[model samples]
Target: MRFTLKQLEYFVAAGETGSIARASERIHVSQPSISTAIAQLEKELNVQLFLRHHAQGLSLTPSGRTLFQEAKRLLEQAGGLYAAASQMHEEVHGNLNLGCLTTLAPMILPELTLSFTSAFPKASVSPLIDHQERLLASLRRAEVDIAVTYDLRLSEDVTFQPLVELPVHALVGENHPLARESRTTLKELAALPLVFLDLPHSRDYFLSLFDMDGLTPNIAYRLTQPDVIRTMVANGFGYTLVNTAPRSNVALDGRTLTRVAIDGSHRPMTLGLATLTALRQTKLLEAFVSHAKSIISQGYIPGMMAP
Candidate 1:
């Protein structure tokens, strides 16, 4: 016999509440409508479901008990269909592979993970840290769903969404002469000891600032890690340029370091989210991207100076 979902829902409601009037109230239908549907269901199955008395509402017979159990299961399955459809509307579950650069990853990933996990609990998030070249390649190959990287030398295959404008700050030891300066120009900074990130992409980007200002950087050291640069700067070694400003607690030794802002409009290094143009966005990726964008807009991004 062909039984509709409405009939099964009516049966479960009646079985649970033990009254047609109460079942109709729960299902938001008229009592007569629910009673007629249940009656039609039992008639179609060629069985007597309810033992209705003059005063009592309704009681399940032996066959009614079996059908009522099956009706509950069917209702649950129907509810699952609705739930699955709703989940599709909001990207609730899927694998999201994301990557971040070394410098920004340490600063941003912790907060991002904590907040995003709470928001999209069903999503499985796998985060990786790598240089820009490898990260961009991963995005192109659809290995990583998204990447957070410096907005310099971006590839065409990757689409970028600006997350934050990270101010480039000069790291100098406490004893350095320019450390006392409230803010110094790139030209003045060029005269001091300079260190590059030593990575090919970043090396060129860092050197170009000096080259654009028509001054040669006084090359003193080449380092890859930001912490190494911070260590050298704190020990009164050569100063280095970095986009993300480190916290005061994250200093080297007891000597406090200084952040000297450039005089002119320096390259505003943007930390942006990148995703492959080709890959179809899953539910998790969409939710993550939405949450990330909201967090960034809400001023959650680190190194954002108060207005």
Candidate 2:
């Protein structure tokens, strides 16, 4: 009346792939073996995991869905466990789900991926890029093991480890009048037309920068994508505020753009890594954190400038 790990593994594969035959082919196990394992799993759990049709394959029942999530988690944890144990030999082997802030993704994630993957050959890295809210949600749901983002609207359920500091700066077209300034003030920049990056917490951060000075931007355009904001600024539509500086001053239209320093009083945004407090500190996560800390500390991460 006991189901084995093999049964659970096969059951999960069948449930996910939607057919015992496909699961068999995918796992390189015989079809009959997969079926028997699934049958044994159902009997041991005293629940019907799937409803089968003549040729249509299989569909999960309510119990099957519940077990599917748990089984997937367990399998991931099992992989992590073996990988963790393997770290003694200076090798990392596991699957990691990484989330990154959409704005910082271009600057940081690539650096992390190139170095981390090269160092750990057996490890697989999957990326999920989104806003702070979405990234935090993924961390809570265990959909992401770690996140690279700014410290915005964070709750106590997650921990943010500060990595680098990138203060807000003004982006303007090369032809714009402000592009000639060596340093500018919030009030001075507020008077110009603003093409805002209207993302979740990021928007709030940009808008909140003016609070101390009692200034507000002259709203001209609103957008979600970062590149579009840059393009807008390059086209001379309006100026925009952003954290990281683009590696190139040229926009998509081949027009040049420029970033001028803001006054010293403005607060800088801190880039950090976030992880759920509830998730255990696995070796894989620790390795990633260590590598990230090394990268940031060395000052090689592109687009990010030290305060």
Candidate 3:
């Protein structure tokens, strides 16, 4: 073949990242090398793969977009060959693309990844953390092999294996009137100012709790990061609702926080592993699923408090 797999690898990286510099950083290659590979690939294929803008970066041409998808599939297949060879010796060894919910990442990823890698020393994991919608989108694009996320608004193409159920909790400052309470209701929370999580699908889940009670929350602040939301609640800005509670009640600012269980029956978010239904499960993926099932359950999670 005129073009090499290395060339296709560089081309795919450039297409995904939209710039030589970013692609270089992504795959730990030099910018000049990536640029040269793309140039060579385009010349060999006799196609203009990308549209270069002055200082803006590259966008894929129509042909490049089509080839990019093919290249990704080819790379996955190539990786599977390596995994298959390892499996012959009864070993699981390959790169795993692990996606996680942003809010859950801080609580789960570090420990989960470290332990999984320790158990299977030959295997490696790369984590991609994002909101629910983006994580699912990445799965559809084959950008993420598996995602640890909530069962919220899942599409038919995705398959979720439920691991644990996390009930909602209302976070409040130490001096807040509700802090002393062991449990609070949606009606009680709706009367107070709410520090909304404000992520795409997550926001809908939180709002739906109030909707179920036929009440509207008095949204005092809207924030994205979970830690920031916790800090805001600690500082007495407003109460926020969350399913996964950290082990500590103290915020990043060292202020005290309290997790009050939500009263009455509400839909609890089920934390699980989500994968594309059509994608073939490799040995490495199967190993991870097994490991996850063993560690993550209703009684225990890697880094967060048990439900």
Worst 10 residues of 3 by lDDT: 85-94
Residues 116-166 of candidate 3: C-alpha lDDT, one tens digit per residue: 999999999999999999999999999999999999999899999999999
Model 1 residue 66 CA deviation in Å: 22
lDDT of 3: 0.92
RMSD of each: 8.0, 17.9, 20.6
Residues 7-69, model 2: lDDT tens digits: 879988898899989999899999999999898888888899999988999999999999989
For residues 1-307, write the lDDT of model 1, one tens digit per residue: 5889998898889988889988988889999889889989988998988889676788899999998998888888989999998877775876678898887787777788778888777767788888888888788777788997887678687788987776676878888898888888888888888866787477787788889889899889988887777777788787888777655524645667788887777777777789887778776777888888887643667544421
Best by lDDT: 3
Better of 1 and 3 by lDDT: 3
User: How close is every model to the real structure, measured as TM-score?
Assistant: 0.73, 0.70, 0.71
Model 3, position 250, has a per-residue lDDT of 91
The order of the candidates by lDDT, greatest first, is 3, 2, 1
